[model samples]
Target: MNLTQKAMLGVSAVAMATALAGCGQTTTYPRTAPPTDSQCRDWEWDSKNGVYRCDDSSSSYYRNYYYGNSYYSSRSALQKSSSYSAYKSSITSKTSSGFGKGSSIGGG
Candidate 1:
C-alpha cells in the first residue's frame, strides 16, 4: 500500500487498540472493616418459653440458660455478627474504591 495509507492504518490500529485496552481494566476497592455494633445488635432474640426467655424488660438476657443452649446462642450471635460485618465491609470497600480520587491502577 502507499505510505500515506499505511500511516493512516497504523494510526487507526493504535486508536482501536487503545480503546479496546480500556475494557480490560482491573476494578478495585479500598479495604474496610464492617459495622460492629449496629448491625449485630438488631438480631431478634428467641423469646419462646422452651429454649430462651427474657430475664427482664432489658433485651439482652435469656432464660433456660443451659450450657449447650448458651453455646449455641453465642455461636449464632457471632455468626450473624460476622456476616453483617462482612457485608458492611464489602459495601464500604466498594464505595471507597469508586470515590477514591487519588487511587488509580498505575502510579501517575
Candidate 2:
C-alpha cells in the first residue's frame, strides 16, 4: 500500500485495539437477587435473626462455617436487620399470601 494508506491503516488498528482493551478491563459490580424458595429451603434458617445459613465453601474467609450445616456468616446487627427486611419483602411480594387470593398462611 502507499504511505498515506499504510499510515491510515496503522491509526485505525491502534484505535480498534484501544477500544477493545477498554472493554476488556471494564469493572463489573456484584448483583444480588431475591433468593428462590428452593434455595432457601435447603438453607438453615436463623429465626432470631432471619438470615439463611449457607456454606461459603468457595470462600477462604468463610470456609470455617462450612462444616455441620453452614451458619449465616456473622454480621453487625444493623446489617442483619436490613437483610432480613429485604428478604421478607421479596418473599411477601412473590408469594400469593402477601397480596394475592391465595391463603396468607401458606407458602407461595
Candidate 3:
C-alpha cells in the first residue's frame, strides 16, 4: 500500500505483538499438609458414643479422621485455613482469542 498505510500496519503489528506477549502465567499452591500431632490436644466429643471412641490415645488431630471428623485443629484454625475446602468447586472460566471480535468471515 502507500507509505502512511505501510507505517500504520507496521506500528499496529508491533502493538499487537507487544499486547499478546504478556505472559500467560499460572500458579497452583497444592493443599497444605493435614494438621500435625503437636497441634492436637485429646479428642472431640461425640453426642452418642462420647469422645475418644476411635482410639483412646488418638490425639485431636487423629480423632478428626474418625467419628468427630474435625478437619482443623481448632475453631480459629478452621476459619483461617486456606485449603479447608468444604464444598466441591462448581466454577468455570473461558478464554477467547480472535482477530478482534467474533464475526462471520468472508460474508456480505
Q: Weakest 10 consecutive residues, lDDT, candidate 2?
A: 63-72
Best by TM-score: 1
Q: Candidate 3 regions off by >4 Å? A: 25-108
Return the top candidate by lDDT: 2
Residue-by-residue lDDT tens digits, candidate 1, 5-95: 9999999777665555544434333332322332132223342211222333333443212222232235345334544347446654563
Task: Give the higher-lDDT candidate: 1 or 2.
Answer: 2
**Of the pair 2 and 3, which is ahead by TM-score?**
2
Q: Tens-digit lDDT track for model 3 on 49-93? A: 222222335444454432224454344454354443321111101
Ranking by TM-score: 1, 2, 3
C-alpha lDDT values of all predictions: 0.39, 0.41, 0.37
Query: Which pairs of residues have clashing backbones in candidate 3?
Result: none
Count of residue pairs whose backbone atoms collide, per candidate: 1, 0, 0
RMSD of each: 15.4, 18.4, 14.7
* Global CA lDDT computed for model 2: 0.41
